[model samples]
Target: MQRYFVAPEQFRGVIITITGEDAHHAARVMRMKPDDQIIVCDGVSRSVRAVVLEASPQEIRAEAEEELLQDSEPAWSITIAQGLPKADKMELVIQKGTEIGASSFVPFESERVIVQYDGKKEAKRIERWSKIAKEAAEQAHRHRIPSIQPVQSWRQMLTLIGEFDLALFCYEREGAAAHGKGIANAVRQWKLEREKSSDEVVQNPRIVLLVGPEGGFSEREAVEAEAAGAILVGLGKRILRTETAGLVGLTCLLYESGAMEGA
Candidate 1:
């Protein structure tokens, strides 16, 4: 069945009214008609299996048959703070990151970043990224779409680091153990500690993964990041590309947190 995300207002007492882009896709693109079955999600944690009652260019209304059980969302709300890379690399990251179970994304500027922020194009850029996230979520059968935050400056991004339960700063260079450890080992230890501290699962725990641009973070930036309560970490033996490192780290984080396996 085709899946569409609806607003809280769109679904009322088992009536799911999909409007705007979803309606256009259902009506014109998919050629959906009355009696067609579909699944509608509220983009948080709730989803309903419904049968289409009416389809038009502006609206497609459906009647809920039963509430669908959804647990696809991860226990941790992971956000990827990517240092703005060149070209469409950020698009690839956001699309794949959403599929990999990221809760949101933050594109920020770093000392080594090449792409300068375009204030005039920022709105359109973010709009495009948001669309990518939504389409990816639907294709991935995700209950919620990942949020794309406004691009932040280096200092501004640093100020937001302490907000997360754990922040892993991705550094390509292999440094002393004091600097960092293998991502798998680090995240596993963190998870173990969390479980030991509280027997109950900590759902919705906030985690932020930071990956620098082409040349990676400078020594000064590294020291500042650690000072801001972020753990400097390496992906593995080989140095991954700017866009790939964060995805790999995110997968490691989610898997270690028991999200990849199941609820």
Candidate 2:
């Protein structure tokens, strides 16, 4: 069945009103008709199994048959604190990250990062990235859309260290011990802790994964990140490009954390 995202206000009882671009897509692109079944996510908590009851040029109304579980979110929230990369790599990062269940992204300017973000350019870049995240969320059938935040400086990134339960910073220049205990080890530690907890309610773990720019992090920057409470970890033996490193790290994190399971 086809799925569409709507606002919570658009749903009143069992009836859901879809307007704007979604309405146009239903009426023109998809050529949907009354009695056709579809899934409608309210972009909040509610997702319903709905069937079209009315279809017009300007709007499409569907009646809710049953409320369904939201399938777009992952079990754990993963936030990527990526150092700004040059060129259009940020666009690909935001789009693919959303599809893979990243809850939020923060692009920071690191010592080794060459791409500088002035106020105006930062605003424009964020706006474009936000649109990409939204579209990717829709295509991925996510219950909630991830946000692409404005670029932050190194100092700003430091202040956010305590916000997450698990924080890992990928450092290519780190010593051999860092390379030995990869992302898999960190994930295993978190899982073991969770299993050992005596509390009945499972605590939702928030992880902050940091990735550096094209030239990677400076030694001073890596030291500062470590001091700020981010555990410097390694990906593998080979060096990965700035664009490729973050995604690979995230993929491993998600799979290991079990966030990529059913959802």
Question: Each candidate's TM vs. the true structure?
Answer: 0.93, 0.88
What does candidate 1's lDDT look like per residue over 1-263, in tens digits?
Answer: 89898778887898889989889999999999999999899997689889999999899989999888888888789999999999999999999999999999999998999987798999999999999999999999999999999999999999999999889888766433445587777677777888888567666789999999988899899999989998888887677889998899899888887887833
> Candidate 1: misplaced stretches above 4 Å?
175-180, 195-201
The prediction achieving the highest lDDT against the true structure is: 1
Give lDDT per model, in order: 0.89, 0.83
- Alpha carbon deviation, residue 146, candidate 2 (Å): 1.0
Q: Which candidate comes out best when scored by TM-score? A: 1
- Clash totals in order: 0, 2
lDDT tens readout by residue for model 2, 1-263: 77888888999999999998788888898899999998888777998899999997699999999999775577678988889888889888888888888899999988888976788677777878987887788788888878777788889998898788888888886424544567777678767887887866355678888998998888888788889888888888778888787788889987886766662
Query: C-alpha displacement of 240 in model 1, angstroms?
Result: 0.9
- In terms of lDDT, the poorest run of 10 residues in model 2 is 173-182
**The 10-residue segment with the lowest total lDDT in model 1:** 171-180
